[model samples]
Target: MDMIAHNDSLQLYASDLYHYPSLKQPLAGLKSTKINLLFGHDEPNKKGVEDWTFSSDHRIFHEKKIPYIYFGVEDHKDYHKSTDTFQNINKSFYIDAVRLIIEAIKAYDSYLPIDSKD
Candidate 1:
């Protein structure tokens, strides 16, 4: 499950973020947060993980044992291609996703030092 904040300021975003019909969206399948931190480099974590960390910026931090949160949609038809332009982005969905990330950060901040197992 997601660990986003449940406060008043973030409450209004529930509809667009959580209630949105992601199942019907081409960029659906919000990946699990914890699983990524655990199995990021392990053969592209597919089972319960949200998405693979193929070539993400998180690799360095993960290698350093610093846990990080990833908020991203699944690959689209234009992923990593020249056609992956801003014009192709669904603005409304992008905005909602950012909002959800903000809320999640607020919630995650409460936990602070998300330490490593070692």
Candidate 2:
């Protein structure tokens, strides 16, 4: 459900480059899912993805070195604008994005170990 306002676009970025392989493996099986793996220059800077620190909740996990996936739409025309309203959202794209996230969570839950200490 990340960045629901924009559309069906999803990007996966990691704080540590080494974490991507594990994060990517499960997502790879999602048929027709167009998630992109961001790295190097494509990866988020210290302030966070798109320099919008509050854009994602995964930052805490990222700081802890826990692998995570970010499901978000790339910035759009209505971003941070007065036009950024519910009516402006692409409904079909939003639905598909949510479905994709659900599938991704199911896959990760099955493969990842639960950290009871957390």
Candidate 3:
């Protein structure tokens, strides 16, 4: 979700930018490469396409009829059950997922401009 927020900001700036967890930290420079939209929910009962096109910056990204990647993980009894514990989490997979998002942000940040506007 944080990555999504940063991407939203990128849509406005359209230039190199980094969003740190804390304002006190230095921002890492980014290079905008491609738009990677992760659509889908982890919950079994919640699955659908997320439409960012209705957003104000809809015109920023090119539209296409092709399909996009959707993070569809199979839901189990522990999907959202209270029994879901950190010990049961897949650490490696989670780390890789986060790394991918970071890489995408870093790549896209380079071409973003702070003064970009509608």
lDDT to native, each model: 0.40, 0.58, 0.35
For model 2 the TM-score comes to 0.65
Where does model 2 exceed 4 Å of error?
8-19, 32-56, 114-118
Q: What shift in Å separates residue 4 of candidate 3 from its native position after superposition?
A: 13
lDDT of 2 by residue, 33-100 (tens): 55453432224444454443234576677667675555555677887788888888876666665666
TM-score of each: 0.52, 0.65, 0.36
* TM-score of decoy 3: 0.36
lDDT of 1 at 81: 74
C-alpha RMSD by candidate, in order: 12.5, 4.7, 13.5
Ranking by TM-score: 2, 1, 3
Task: Name the candidate that leads on TM-score.
Answer: 2
Cα misplacement distance, residue 97 of candidate 1 (Å): 0.3
Evaluated against the true structure, the overall lDDT of model 2 is: 0.58
The positional error of residue 40 in candidate 2, measured at the CA in angstroms, is 8.8
Write model 3 residue lDDT over 3-29, tens digit each, in one string. 222221122122111111221112233
Q: Give the 10-residue window scoring lowest on summed lDDT in candidate 3.
A: 15-24
